[model samples]
Target: MEAVVFDGNKLKLSYEKNYPKPEILDDDDVIVEVHYAGICGTDLHIIHGEFPAIKTKPIALGHESSGVIHAVGKNSVYKVGQKVAIDPNKACNLCDFCHKGNYQYCLTAGINSTIGIWKDGGWAQYVRVPQQQIFALPDEITTEQAGLCEPYSCVSHGFNRASPLKVGERILVLGAGIIGNLWITTLHHHGHREVTVSEMNLTRLDIVKRLETGYRLVTPDVLAKENTTYDVIIDCTGVGKVMEISFNYLREGGKYVLFGCCPPAHTTSLNPFQIYNKELTIIGVKINPFSFPSAISWLKAMGSRYVDYHKLGVKTYALSEYADAMEDLKKGSVAKAVFKVVKD
Candidate 1:
């Protein structure tokens, strides 16, 4: 099978020599033919050698993947040719976290669950997944829509972590990219009255502003408005400076949520007095748990209530155009860049 392999020094579209065809590695595993996969920001970081600790050499790199079950092993509940969204995070069910359904935090953490980073992922024509992580795609959801399940799940998990958005509360989402834009939509979907977004790129801001959810625009100067604050602030930009500024927008009892991944070794300087005086709550969320299912449900609820998934939120690329996709992401050119494998 053709697979996008990462071997530290280079990432290339190559045929796996003596590639291991899908076989029942475990009785509970299912073999899948990957139809579509999303190239995520984390994939970019991995390719550039930012995450040297988690990954070591030649591996398939994609987490947001959807496809059809080509085969299933013994004792499996899935049937051949069943459309499914594979959860990449495969946790050790024996672990305490897994026992509590927090599998993403499992001790034996594998490809953030199956195919993508950490293992031979979905960027290929085929992948083997544990049956437990597979969710049947609803009939109304297309292969393209299933591609969004993972990322949206991450955003939903962040919202879940910062639950109970007051109806009239105001929110500021930093970064108007995929995650940032999704945060705004989710807040509005839940009835948050006034939501604002701060983005440095005018092009991105223009797209977001046009969404016109009665959302306010905040440049650096605008955000510095004297005594101006928000009931809740979500930092999706992941920039340290933006994280710092996000705190300033939070009211005394307001909550601050950091959804973006800042450099693991990075640090930010902040005023301790402000945190103490305002009683701010700085919350951080990792990956999804019960978040993907919620995202799919929410999306399906908006059935045919299109939000232009491929326009503002997605940019399509062919499998061989991985380099172009990576470049698009590095240049901050697209909200989401997806490599369409097995194109119709």
Candidate 2:
């Protein structure tokens, strides 16, 4: 099988023609034939040696993927040929956090326990994962859309952490990438009307405008000059400077949701006196935790019309085009990039 492997010594991924096929190791495992796999920002971080603590060398690099079951173990509840979305997250059931239903924070295995990060994942024709990590996709959800499940689930978890978006409260999303746009769509789906987006990329800003999502778009420079504030501000850029500046736009007593993944070594300074005086809440979202089911349901309810809007500026490439896709992503030419592994 052809696979994209990260050897940990280089800054780029290597495509191999004869990667080993996955075999079912445990009774609760399933082997899936990957159809579509998303290229995430975290993947770039891993390739650049940002996540040295979690990443293992020579691992297949993909976590957001959708596929069909190629084979299932005897104890697996899933059947062969079942279409599913990969959750990627795995946790030790015995952990204290797992017992409290906060599995993403499980002590033994959590974010680092994800598929592509710590183990061989779906950047190939086939991947073997535990049965509990696969979620059956509804008939209405296409394989391409199913590839978005993992990212959408992460956004859902972020929203849950910053809950209770009251009526008439202004909301701002800083960034127009895939995760930021998903936050806009999810907010719209849930009936939040007053939302604004801040992005420096004019191309992405135009894409959001074309969708007619009714979101007010502005450049960071313009937003900073306007002296505008939001009741809730979400930072999805994951830049240290942006994270530090985002606090200026948050209202007193408002919530600041950090949904983006910053480099582990990057550090930003915050004022303790402001946090004390404003009584502001700074919430950090790790990854999806018990939110995949709700994300799927929400996607189904929103239907293709909305999903198609989210798909704008998204480009798909074959597994052989991984280098091209990564180049495009690094150039900020595409809002989202996916590798079409199978013809589906």
Candidate 3:
């Protein structure tokens, strides 16, 4: 078998020299033949040494992956050859957070992101995963769409965290990237028509404009001068200055969701007067917990109406073009860059 191995921040395809085929490791473990893997900003951060200290040498690197069950452990309920979406987060169910249904907060929560920065990920032909972390894809969803379930789960988690969105409320999503776009789609699905997004990049704005929806794309300069206020302001830019500027657009008592991941040491300033006088409900979403089920069900229901799951992001690499893939992403030529591991 061939795998895209990450060695010292560099990616290279290597033959499995005496590497055993993935097999069920425990009663709850299942071996999967990886089909597709999605590369995200986290992958870039890891490569640039911006993330927390991770696996330092050669390792597998994918987490957002989808594939078929190659083999199931003795006690696992999943059947062989079943199509599934992999939830990369592995948690100790015995932990306090997991016991309370907050697996994302579990102290032992982690994943073996293969072909990724940590554990061997799904950038290979086969991966070992826990049965509990897999979700069966609906028949209508393709492998590419199934792969999207991971990021969708993250978006769904954000929506769950920001519940009770008032109808007719105005929403301001700061950032026109994947996270920003997902928020727009999610808001539209839930009947919020007044959602507006702010993006400075003209290219990204053009991409959003091509979607042909009610999403209003604006530049920071426009937002700064506009007198309009929003009931919900979501900071998806992950920039401190962006967040600081977005705060002024929030209506009194409005809700603000910090949806993007900022740098570990990053900090942003907020006006204390606004907090005391206007009484804003500021919320932050970290990771998904029990969000996969809802995300799958929502995708099934929406089908192609709200999301062109097939075209949500750009796919531009064969299994071996890993370097070019990362380059395209860095150049902002692709949105959600994905690597194809298995073919149809």
Highest TM-score among the candidates is held by which one? Answer: 2
**All models: lDDT?**
0.75, 0.86, 0.75
Please report, as a residue range, the 10-residue window in candidate 2 with the lowest summed lDDT.
50-59
Q: Per-prediction RMSD in angstroms?
A: 2.5, 1.4, 2.7
lDDT of 1 by residue, 88-185 (tens): 87666687887888876775764344457667778887888889889888888887778777877888888888987778887778888877877777
What is the per-residue lDDT of model 3 for residues 1-344, given as tens digits with 9 covering 90 to 100?
A: 66766665453434353445666669988888888888876666666665642446676677788988898889998999899998877567787877888776765564322224456678788888878888988798777667777778888888878877887888888987777777777787777888788877776777676455667788889988889999999888777677877888888889999988776667779998898789988888866777889888877876776566333545646667877887777766555677777865
Backbone N/Cα/C clashes per model = 8, 0, 13
Q: What's the residue-level lDDT of 303 in candidate 1?
A: 48
Cα displacement (angstroms), candidate 2, residue 317, comes to: 0.9
Clash list (residue pairs), candidate 2 = none
**Number of backbone clashes in candidate 2:** 0
lDDT of model 2 at residue 134?
93
Residue range with the least summed lDDT across 10 consecutive positions in model 3: 108-117
What local lDDT score does residue 54 receive in model 1, on the 0 to 100 scale? 35
Best candidate, lDDT-wise? Answer: 2
- Candidate 3 ranges beyond 4 A from true positions: 8-21, 110-117, 309-311
Evaluated against the true structure, the overall lDDT of model 3 is 0.75
